[model samples]
Target: MSKTNAARILDRLKLPYEILEYAVDPDDLAAESTAEKLGLPPEQVFKTLVARGDRHGVCLAVIPGSAQLDLKALAVLAGDRKTDTVPLKDVQPLTGYVRGGVTALGTKKAYPVYVDELMLTFETVAVSAGKRGLMLWLAPQAYLTATQGIVGAIARSSPP
Candidate 1:
């Protein structure tokens, strides 16, 4: 497969990563499913979310596939009083990535990136390759450095 903008950015940074592709199930775009398809546990896969802070405008929140973004926690980290996920209709225009394909590496703009501290526990984490059906696997620290990500407790366990 041709390289994606995310991969290109990694190359420019001289970071090593592996691209893995799976069959895309349009009906099941959940990160959990993506992890399953890749034979990985959900927490090993990170999903990027777009959130708008009342003061900071837009930022990226990356959390484990099995967790959910904690808006309040994110707001604290972004230094905003309030934050909410951007509307679905605004996601593509804002980040140049569709729902299932969003990644913090190479967005349309360099929005501040907030990554859940959980990712640091793993040697490598999987994130979208700027498109659906494709995933990028790299050392968490390398990915964080590439995106200039801020680490924080910005995610919470999904409700049972």
Candidate 2:
């Protein structure tokens, strides 16, 4: 079901993408860990985060595995007073994809999407393929076009 959704999205966009599957230990499901397990650079891997803002409504943020989402920056970008992570329990139903499988593209709802500027450093980036153990490698522009996402610096340096 997950791979099907991702394939459908790719077909619709007419974009070329490569799907990479790897073994994922349920207990270690995190972007950085996943990247390490896949032998990919952390900066080339992105994590989809669901956040709600006071005025901009619910939005999706895609940031590097090594960076943190800058709530204040996101709020400013969304023209809102504040931003908060959406509850995990509500994420699946809200995005139509399970927790670790959430992708900015092909979501159940069409919400505003913001991509961290860091992703631009890579010619191709990896993101979840609507399922755990599966990832898609594609050009960053394809994601923006597919999701109608806005690109900006909504990421902060990882806590030291």
TM-score of each: 0.99, 0.95
- The digit string of per-residue lDDT tens for model 2 on 1-160 reads 2455876888887988888888888888889898998899888999999999999788999999988999998888888899998999989888998888899878898889988988888899999888898998889888778777788899987887
Q: Model 1 scores what on Cα lDDT? A: 0.96
Model 2 stretches with alpha carbons more than 4 Å out? none
**Candidate 2 structure, TM-score to reference:** 0.95
lDDT (tens digit, per residue) of candidate 1 on 42-63? 9999999999999989999999
> What lDDT does each candidate get?
0.96, 0.87
Q: Which RMSD does model 1 reach against the true structure?
A: 0.5
Maximum-TM-score candidate:
1
| Candidate 2 lDDT | 0.87
